[model samples]
Target: MSPSLEKILSEIEQLTPEEQLTVMGHLVERVKKHITQVQPKRKWSDLKSMAPYPLLGEDAQEWVSRTRKFADEHREGLQREE
Candidate 1:
């Protein structure tokens, strides 16, 4: 262990059981706060490289048109049912 960590442990050891518990709780809260403040770093290039398939050109346009048509038909069917 690092000297700083060893020193902290020694200081913790010097406390009474109740005081140690309080110190432990405070440390846990501090660690939780620190973890929450940390954010994962990502790049757009990295994300794009990981895509299963590229989205470009005629296929994407056709897909969007087909989806809109399907949604319109489904909504009309639901209205008829009501």
Candidate 2:
């Protein structure tokens, strides 16, 4: 639709069928590399789906609560020290 895209398509069309196929393979590899790069970002969602999280059940909740309490109790002291 755009001039740049149309120009690229025109050039690609000028190539022989075999050349086009080779170029297509290179593009596919580049796309696969991009997908692999983005895979790590799904780790948080994956953690929820995977069984046996590092911390689990009541222990995790209690740890979170205790951490919150500690943060709250020392809030003024921590802020002043910083």
Candidate 3:
């Protein structure tokens, strides 16, 4: 950890329970504000047309099944040779 953060953490440890809770609340609010400013809300529509229909000229499920079948057959063949 950085020296500044380590010092701050040591100071926070000395604080009473109520003071710690107050500090935690302020930190949470600060983090929320930073996050909102850094990342804008996204909509599902943003992904529309990101990929053409069937995505690479092959149906998604068909591609997955084809790859899995190929992998399984290759594995079984390897096992038989063992």
Return the top candidate by TM-score: 1
- Over all chains combined, what TM-score does candidate 2 have? 0.44
Q: Which residue ranges in model 2 land beyond 4 Å of their true spot?
A: 38-82
User: Each candidate's lDDT (Cα)?
Assistant: 0.87, 0.84, 0.96
Off by over 4 Å in 3: 37-82
Candidates sorted by TM-score, descending order?
A: 1, 3, 2
Q: Model 3: which ten-residue window has the lowest total lDDT?
A: 32-41
Q: Candidate 2 on 1-82: residue-level lDDT in tens?
A: 9999999889999999999999899999999988776443555765675666544655777898999999997997888898
- Clash number for each model: 0, 0, 0
| CA lDDT for candidate 3 | 0.96
Instruction: Tell me how many residue pairs clash in candidate 1.
Output: 0
What is candidate 3's CA lDDT for residue 22?
99
Residue 11's lDDT within candidate 1 is 95
TM-score of each: 0.47, 0.44, 0.46
